[model samples]
Structure formats: C-alpha cells, structure tokens
Target: MPSKKEIEEVLKLDAEKRFSYTIKRIADFEFVWAIGDQHGFANYGDDNGNVAFAIWPFEAYAALCCKADFANCKPEAIELDFFQEEYLTDFKDRKMRLAIFPLPTDKGILIDIEEFEQRLQKELDEYY
Candidate 1:
C-alpha cells in the first residue's frame, strides 16, 4: 500500500478541463470530511429537493482520475441533475465536485477516480 504522503502526492494531480463544464465547492455539510479527517462521497438531498452529486476523498483526486461529477453522471441517463447540484472548484482549471462522506468501517478509503469514471460510463451504457 502507498504511504499517506505517497497517496496524497498521487491524489494531488490536476484533473479539471477533462470533464466538460465548470465546478466549484459549496458551503454545505457534504463537503465536510468523515472522521479522522478522511472524506467520503455520495449525493444527498438539497434545499431544492433533488439528489445531487458527491465525490469522495477530494476534487483534485477526482480530476486526476478522470471521474465525472458524481451527480452529473448516471447510467440511467446522461442527465446532469442526476448528480449533485453544482460542482466545486478551488481554482480555475483545478475544478471538481467532491464531497466528504462516512465509511461503514469508519475507515476512509481513497476512491479510484478512474474506476469511478469507468463505472459511471458503464452505468450510462447499461442503464441509461
């Protein structure tokens, strides 16, 4: 397994522009990391009463791996609303729609952005 520093280093790649449209972080609870400062990902209900997208770990991590806005993605259909409300960004080109979620084991797991992309695409093809 990669050390925390090594993993952190790898997860720090810039992966915006890869996905169409812009994203920025929001002032919401989903943005908060799980216990131990470890973050999770999953869309939750918003004031608008819609299911939004939520990326786990962090945005840069999501970008580096080629994952789409967790909410914008759906195998059922390529509908943006299927994901989160609006994506988040720390800076220009360094865009993302990430979130911090809770892990069942209470252990944070760094997500595979690439794998998330693949699975999402498959979901698009198979379901959507």
Candidate 2:
C-alpha cells in the first residue's frame, strides 16, 4: 500500500497521469475500489448531464471521496476478474462512462468503456 504522501502526490497529478497511475496500480494489485452502500455505487455527473461510474485503484482514494452525494457510501473492493468480466461488460452495455480516481476537488478522468478497456489492457501488458 502507498503511504499518505504518495497517495497525496498521486491525487494531485493531472487527470491523465492520475488515470494512468490508477490503471497501473490496479493492474499490479488485481483489484479496484469503488464507494457504495447497499443501494448502488457512487456516480459523478458533468454539467452536460453526462454520468460516469466512479472508481479508484485504492481504498484510501475511494474513502477520501466519501462526501457530498456519496457521504453514506463505504469503500468496496472488486476483484479485477469480476471488474473486467462483469462490471466493464455491464457498463458498456449501458453505455456508461468511467470516472477514474475522482477526488472531492477533482472529477477525475471521464472515459468511455472502450477507451478504458484499451488503456487498462496496455497497463496489464506492461505489468506482466
């Protein structure tokens, strides 16, 4: 696990760097984090009304985002296999976008499922 300083530095990175870092981390860890309770997972919306399913590479990152609309949610981990086989397929079927590693101050990177898949694949290739 990353220290507080490392996590803070990652959080301060630009959206593209943050997204790439998250992808690399997730590939290395073989899991991903999301904030949610019994109802459903947390989501983010843009001014244009575009909605995205928010995700993170670490529990600390997801836990830090538990505010505002997601105050009641808790950090939950999804194994990489389930994320790739189930969540990604479902999100793509619903035409949902991804908000990777969103912070309270930053909405993070909003990417469609196909692009996210491609990027994640690239990271996994390098990880192996």
Alpha carbon RMSD to native, model 2: 1.1
How accurate locally is residue 42 in candidate 1, as Cα lDDT from 0 to 100? 40
- Looking at candidate 1, the ten consecutive residues that score lowest on lDDT are 18-27
Best by lDDT: 2
Model 2 Cα lDDT, one tens digit per residue, 91-117: 988888999988899989899999988
Task: Report the alpha-carbon TM-score of model 2 versus the true structure.
Answer: 0.95
lDDT of 1 at 5: 84
| Candidate 1 lDDT, 31-119, residue by residue in tens | 32211112433443334444334343334333332323333322211123323232222211232222223122221222333443453
Residue 120 in model 1: lDDT? 41
Question: What's the distance in Å from true for residue 33, model 2?
Answer: 0.4
